[model samples]
Target: MKQVLGSCLCNRVTYACENNFSQFHLCHCTQCQKATGSAYAANLFTDVDNIKWLTGEALIMRFNVAGRSISNAFCGECGSAVPYKSLSGKALVVPAGSLDCEPNIQPQSQIFYTERAPWFDSVTVCKKFDSMPK
Candidate 1:
């Protein structure tokens, strides 16, 4: 089976997951935007049992939105996103940005498109810089 490694920003937390992802979703919902502090969240969905924490498991923190299905997890030390089981208890949601390598699957769909931010629409048309502005 394929495997992928992931780490938090400070490298305080590390993990590995069997790349058995069934879906890749770019969520534009309001909750997802707030949790990621970005235009959208790239998440990979897989069975909850597929992940294994390599280190800093104690530093992982999870938050579930009250009365909502939205939830997220992060590394306590670096505030970097991490994988967590979905509220439904069926699948694990892995933050694509946290992965050290790309997964086999590409994004399957963009959800909550109607809730997307106005500025998000023009991002694709903006200049693409290879690196930091100089």
Candidate 2:
């Protein structure tokens, strides 16, 4: 099994996960944009068991958004968003950009397309969903 390691800017918080990701997505929701301080968020979803925390468990913090518990585990010193676990308590969604190794994955879909900022370009390429695409 392949493994990938990642850490915050200060290196106080570290994490590792299975290199094989089950799903990848770019979220354009306002919550994601604010949380990441970016136009969009690139997330790689994998089983919770595949993720391992190497350091700084005490510094991790969490917040609930729209009833979903979004854990914003980060380095308290650097304030960098590290890894986040779902409130469902089933999976870990790591920011692809935070990985130390380049993950062989690309955004398969864009979610919350309707909520995307007006300045953002419409994702005409890959599948786009207005909401969660349920």
Candidate 3:
């Protein structure tokens, strides 16, 4: 199994993942854009059971963005985004930018394409979605 390491900006909260990843996606929904304050968010989906928190459980904080049922986790000290789990409690989504080592994965698709900001750069040829696909 491959292992990947990640930590918050303060180095307080750390985590590790095994088995590389099967899917990578970039989300551009308004909620994601507002939460990340960026053009889009790069996320890697992996089994929740495969992740292990290595440190600073006490410094981790969670926020539920308005109107979005999903909650986002981050470091309380340095405010660095951490991995987030789905409300269904089945999987984990780790931000590629937060990884301590390169994730060695590229987004396979872009989601909420229609909601993407007008000024956001257009890159990648992956499939695009107007919203979470039904």
Candidate 2 achieves a global lDDT of 0.80
Q: Write the per-residue lDDT of candidate 1 for residues 57-117, one digit (tens) a residue.
A: 9999999999889999999998989999999999999999999998879999999999998
lDDT of 2 by residue, 11-130 (tens): 888888879888899888888888888878888888877778898868877667766444555567887777777778788888887899977677799988898877677545558778
Model 1, position 5: C-alpha lDDT score: 99
TM-score for each model: 0.97, 0.82, 0.83
Clashing pairs in 3: none
Better of 2 and 3 by TM-score: 3
**Which of candidates 1 and 3 reaches a greater lDDT?**
1
**For candidate 3, lDDT tens digit of each residue in 28-117?**
888778778898888888887778889997888888876676567889999888987877788888888889877767779998989998
**Reference-based TM-score, model 3:** 0.83
